[model samples]
Target: AYFKEKGKEVIYDAEHFFDGYKSNHAYAMRTLQAAAQGGADCLVLCDTNGGTFPFDIFKVVQEVKKNFGIKIGIHTHNDCGMAAANAIMAVEAGAGQVQGTYTGFGERCGNANLSTIIPNLQIKQHYICIPENQLVNLTKTARKISEIANVTLNERDPYVGNCAFAHKGGMHIDGVCKASSSFEHINPERVGNKRRFLMSEVSGRKTILDKIQEINPSVTKDS
Candidate 1:
């Protein structure tokens, strides 16, 4: 009523939705209905404490879709290290939208990492979030956001991280040397990143051979 009077849009964030659903599933459904009745354009189910696992997220979201028959969105945090996975699972289970931040930057453990989610959606799952031409800027955008926030980027942050594509173990490097896809989930360059062969004590003969060939094409493992 207030929003209608003010002519403003309503986007109800169902805060602590996961916990609420766990406590009383019926009550949570009612709350969503109430929000929809009050003119919410989007109903965002939130994992406020970030404890919801991916499986539960998927199941609950599936139920929500069946019952409500309305558009659903997902908002997750990272306390349990399942935020990104939870968001992805929700979308897989029928969520129309996902709420996240660049680099997963937020309070406490942070929000779902759009950096990870974007590539997993567009490249792997074949969902079109942005144009193909602009996908390359994802890594650069993540770094730029970190710089603006005056925070050092996490090198292991899924696709955009410096070490996300780095391989170090002997067997892993061997697999990558033979077939990049064997050791890598996606081609790093697809997201403006690069595959890196990290030299370590775990280096195998294949690793050494690949490195030599990079420096001099005429070199062979036999030599």
Candidate 2:
């Protein structure tokens, strides 16, 4: 009431929402109701412990949307290694916004990874969140944030990882070399990354062919 003297919009975050909903569904719904009645502009459901699965997150968010007419948001952590997955699923179930960090950096594992989420939503899912040009700088942006935070970037991190598009297996190498989309789900270049073929026992001739060409574009298969 005091803060809203100027008609400022307020958001109410229901922390530990999954746990609270599980413990007492009525109380959790009531909390959201109270916030809406009190003029909250948005209601964010937090996965405080970060243990809820993506399916559960989707279900709970669906329920919240069904019952409340206010804008719905979601906050997730990576304790179960599903923060990104859960966030995506929640959006699928009608969440308006997803709260996350650059490299999923935060307390108790970390938050959802916007690095992974942004591209997935914009490029793959075709959701309009940011400018199209913003997608091109995702990889460099992730690395920069990681550097600023003094955290080693995960090579296997989706979309922006060094190894996200690396192919090693003989079959995979052959397939990707023939057609990149065969073995890769998304174009690495779409997220400012390039495809890589790691030299290994399983590497195929095509792998060497591609690498040789990368090193010296003039080199041909006959040579």
Candidate 3:
């Protein structure tokens, strides 16, 4: 009420919300009700410890959205390596907003990875979080953020990671050679990344044949 009277929009962050909800369901809800009464424009449920499971997040967020008429948001930490999953679950349960770090850096383990969450929502689920053209710069932005933070970009990070679309194994390379979709979830270029074919003994003959054929279209497997 104070903020609202002063012409301010308050986005209330319910810290340790999942933990509180698990420990005391009624009290946790009472706290949110109080925040609503106090004129919070949006209620952001936070998994402070990052210990909550995705299933629990989904269930609780669903309940919160069902009971409240206000806008809902989610903030999850990556302590359990489930932040992205938990955030996605919350969205599936009807939360309209998600909070995360661009490069997944934060206190302790880290925060939910926006790099992972955005693509998951936009490319796979058909949700639009940003301008379609901006989405293509995801990998570039992630790399830039990592550089500014002086942290080496995680090569295995989904969508923007170096190895996220790399293929090295023989069968895998063959499948990718036949059709990129055979081995990749989506085009790496979608996020401003690229396909990488690692040259190694284990890459198999089919991979070599594909490469040779790229230069010499008449090349045959028997030859």
RMSD of each: 2.3, 1.7, 2.1
> In candidate 1, where is summed lDDT lowest over 10 consecutive residues?
1-10
Candidate 1 lDDT by residue in tens digits, 1-223: 5896698977789999999998998899899999888877778899999999999999999998887766889999999999999999999999989999999999899999999998889888999888998889999999999999999999999889999999889899888868988988888888898888877898887777878899898988778
lDDT of 1 at 130: 87
Q: Estimate each model's TM-score.
A: 0.88, 0.92, 0.92
Model 3: residues with Cα > 4 Å off, grouped in runs = 206-223
Q: Residue 162 error for model 1, in Å? A: 1.0
Q: Flag the better candidate by lDDT, 1 or 2.
A: 1
With candidate 1 superimposed using the best TM-score fit, by how many Å does residue 201's alpha carbon deviate from the native? 2.3
CA lDDT scores, all candidates in order: 0.90, 0.89, 0.93
lDDT of 3 by residue, 1-223 (tens): 9889999989999999999998999999999999998989999999999999999999999999998899999999998999999999999999999999997988899999999999999898989889899988999999999998899999999999989999999999888878989989998898999988777979899878878988999999998
* lDDT at position 97, candidate 3: 91
lDDT of 2 by residue, 11-93 (tens): 88899999999999999899999888888888999998999999999999999999889899999999998999999999999
Query: Relative to the unseen true structure, what is the C-alpha lDDT of residue 155 in candidate 1, on a scale of 0 to 100?
Result: 97
